[model samples]
Target chain A: MTDTAIEAADLTLAYGRRREPALRGCSFRLATGRVCALVGPNGAGKSTLLALAAGLLRPTSGRLAVLGTTPAAARPRVAYVAQDKPLHPGLSVAETLRLGAELNAGSWDAALAAQVAADGELDPGARVRSLSGGQRTRLALALALGKRAELLLLDEPMADLDPLARNRLMGTLMAEAAEHGTTVVMSSHIIGELADACDHLLLVSGGRVRLGGGIDDLVHAHALVTGTGRVADLARHTVVESRATGRGLTALIRTDGPVDPAWDVEEPSLEELLLAHLRAPDAPALITPGTTPTRAVAA
Target chain B: MVEYRIDRRSGVATYLQIVQQTRQALRLGLLEPGDKLPTAREVVEATAVNPNTVLKAYRELEREGLVEARRGLGTFVRRSLGGAPADTPLHGELLEWATRARAAGLDREDTAALFAAVLEEKFPQPHAAPEQAVPQPQPPPERTLPQPQSVPHGTTTEGDPA
Candidate 1:
């Protein structure tokens, strides 16, 4: 088994006692050296989990570890780029890299930082305040890349980038991660380009992990079943989302047992699966690998 | 270097698609031994996929003895597939049979069923699963399961008062 880069067991974090915990009983192990995509709708505890993993926030109760140690211990080796891609407005492009090098101490790679500057087409002398939003994001990423951290936590790194810039940045980050064997955990919209870049998936909803595992294993286990009439036999499978398809009903379901022969079962597209989970916030979870995936009645 | 393209939404997995594309290239004479596969960066630039994904595909190919990853250099094709081209003698023979099947007024699905039955009869493997041995490449246009004989049971169950 691969070592977990991050682990949370019975973890709960709440900003205020009266407010719903941003995260509740959140538990999942992200394997080392894999690019993982964290997906959920707004206010679904995604950002809270990332913040917790970054040591920026402390849990109210329960345990969380990054790289087999507490997040505080892992902080120096972990690089987190926030959703806003924050940067010092007065610093020039060159100065930002220099600041990054200083902050990261001995781990900084000045050459990689220079190459990113060139690729982003930012003049070393250009001030951050003068750069466009996309340019600032590129510079923010350049600093993150220069750190050469063991774990890179990115929050929607491509949100502001154009398609071409997004592709180039993803390519650079992926190649760099591969060359360095760094683990990357990035959060993105439920439907984002380059999701295929992530090999593992962690879906959080309703303040808990709805499902988490290798992308292939999850996709292969679930199916899109379509059939006429309510499939009473399928009442036992963990139905995620279902709707009337004019004449028949189409439903996405997670199952280890046999499906009723009445339905035409096909593998679900990645988008279909994600939308299913997002559409049904209370969709029964398949969190722990060995637990029987909870079944739901036709809805 | 060979370019890798993948469908992010298709039933096929991206890495599996990469593996299949590499194998297809080998069979098509497009990729040969000693040719370097696209670097992880090249693949990411073209496909915008996870770099680890490309590396995983390469590792799979290596495990299958099709390619080898050299440290600090790049992954290389280990050997030629040395198999027949995509269009084998069997393909030409199938085309000839298709013409006869059409003249005989067999519908698309009827032709497939006939072919499946013949294949099952002539080349049945002792240990293969029923579906694999029959090799139905397409999902049946109509529902293939819930055999007609079993329909009455479901109908009766529906008729039962809950």
Candidate 2:
């Protein structure tokens, strides 16, 4: 069995006859049994990437795979929870979940769906239109979970949830992923929430993957160092993103080896790393952070 | 079938609460070797706590050899302590006090006296059962239960009465 749940190689996609591609040369492999967050600013092509993975939109160039099969061939193994709520407005929660089970053409566990609904605090008798935003999101999650797909794709799963609801939903997703070994690729704008839950992260910006790796390794490779001396002296070794405080300059430096004790070194958070990449021009083609880059394969 | 309770108003982090409850369950023989735990998802739903918190607790438990995770099968009670002495991590006692304080509506100061009284009444130190001995099987002490406090709007504790 292939260890990868989803793989994309040199993918370039555009909407209709649009002059510019929505996503260009995007490539990444989502390993099985890991939670990956696809993060980017608005119009950074997060949706396009998810769509290509889900087989909802065909890529104009390159290849995509879901569960070691071409996107089309792996449709049954992939479950896409679209950004637009896809529930039937007329259907009650139970009926909506039932319909999903019927439509997926994959293993569907009715009992699991009922359990997920109950766990998410959704009343099966409630109609879809009557549910609150958080409830609707939970219902979507339940529907996705019940499908028992090998790869689950979620687009902005926490978009409409309040802080508390978001926490609860994230928790549910994490638990489900850990317990079942489900390979999940979810997109989110909430960087902090994603940092806490996801083991691996993908930062997509300007139609390319600027940062990708395990969270710890990324943090270790990028040191937030502050010094009193002119930062240009440090520029050769580090990427200076900012200067700060009264007397010192704070720089985000990429180091190939252990950090020197002379400089106060702190790990850059996921958000800091993302912002740095999004700001730089002609950024490294792929910054694997503390590891060698893997070969990009077209599905 | 370990029974656990959590007060949403507690100052303690939820993961610490989970650790204490798991320890208590072990001491009480409520769970046996190989007993399945509610998946992290189930625990979060049951307690209304963060999933990461549940994971943190489970991870600690796994490290302590108190629980084991079976890939695709969920977490399970691995080895039973059987009333034997077990190491209570530093956070464990802090968590117990926090839980009691919330239940009784007491602040940090009030927790000490109540904790002392309970300790003296149950396992007096010395012949005192080991620090991690089974929670003395006594009826829950009769402390003045806190009157329900009006929770502030938008606070996470709003729905949960203290």
Candidate 3:
């Protein structure tokens, strides 16, 4: 099987005949056994992309694969938790878990499900409707954990969770990744929180890919340069965002070559860098796997 | 007993931040030899960071001889930076000198600049021996810490931390 958990080539999709495409020409490769964070503004098709990966929606045109199989074919091996974390309200937590186990009979992990329940402080006897939002999220994650699927596609998995619960869930998820080599794709609006868990990134905006690559390479390639006189025009790097400072221009730029010695250069935080790319959605994406920006993404 | 907390807003890498918090705790004598560090799972749960990130930080500390991992128990502090408190004789002299410099009307930044310059002159750095040729200075404790080892540069860039 291919090492990539998700791969798409010129993927595009539209909801209806006259509707604007929810995703446009999206292409990227997310390696197996890595946690990738998906981030963008609301209405930027983040949900659409997750749904597509989970086999809930078909790409209108172009090829997409999950776990080296078509998303639909991979459904049995992939566990997906929607934003709402849908579960039967009348069922007790134990019953909910029991139902998930029944549905995923061949691969269900009772131990993992129990661990998640314990971490979230869930009582299996409690009814789903009596649970808090965070508790419901926990139950949804527990259901996913019990499935023991190879790839997990989670949309805002931590949204309803408190900070402590969120951290615990991420910790549990990370342990799963390390122990079992599971590939996870999680969409979150919390940039800092996402940066902590995801080593790779796939940033989308307005239904188009803004950038994609290892987070370290992406961060290292870009820098914040503050210097005198039209620093934005620095020849080597691609200026992502530029602003006038008291003395001159301070810009966030992507540099493959050495930054000029005159500028006061600092590494931009992930949030700053992500926000810059998201702010300039029209700028051409730099599909970088390493230092050299070798691929030119289609416009 | 020092718990590492990651400030996501900071430019520091997660592992480096963990290392810095440990070192900072050491400097303040909050963490002593034989004290246990939070387990990898515990850190991951508290910080919401990748488990590997926590392991990487602990590994870095182990490499530095600052902490040791016993078989399945937990990581423990092996030693400390052993900095003296601010009231030490060396600091007393520095404070006395600072008062005189202030009386001479040196602004805060100027005083700091002049003090750094004087310290560098008086304690000229050791001549670069074969082993000491690299000139990378340690980052200030407050600045965003970096882990050249954890964060590798693409294509082996010259300024890459490693």
Stretches of candidate 2 above 4 Å error?
A16-18, A119-126, A285-299, B1-162
Query: In model 2, what is chain B's TM-score?
Result: 0.52
| A1-299: candidate 1 lDDT, tens digit per residue | 22668878777999997999989987777778878888887888888898888999998987887877789888888888898878989989989899999988899988887887788899899999999988888888888888888888988888898888887888787787667778998888745574677878888887899878877677777888888957555678778888889898998888757676667777776678888888887877665462222222011
Ranking of all predicted structures according to DockQ, beginning with the best and ending with the worst: 3, 1, 2
Q: List candidate 1 stretches off by more than 4 Å.
A: A288-299, B7-12, B27-30, B39-42, B59-74, B78-162
lDDT of 1: 0.76
TM-score of each: 0.77, 0.68, 0.77
**How well is each residue in A104-143 modelled by candidate 2, as lDDT tens digits?**
6558867767776786688889999999877888888888
Ranking by TM-score: 1, 3, 2
* Cα lDDT of model 2 by residue, B1-162, tens digit: 553465544644456677778877766567767788887767754554445557877887777667789998989876655423244353576687589778878876687787788768764544344453332221212222232334332222212111
Q: Which of candidates 1 and 3 reaches a greater DockQ? A: 3
Q: Give the TM-score of candidate 2.
A: 0.68
Angstrom error at residue B17, model 1: 3.3
Tell me the DockQ of each model, to 2 decimals. Answer: 0.24, 0.08, 0.25
How does the DockQ of candidate 3 come out?
Answer: 0.25
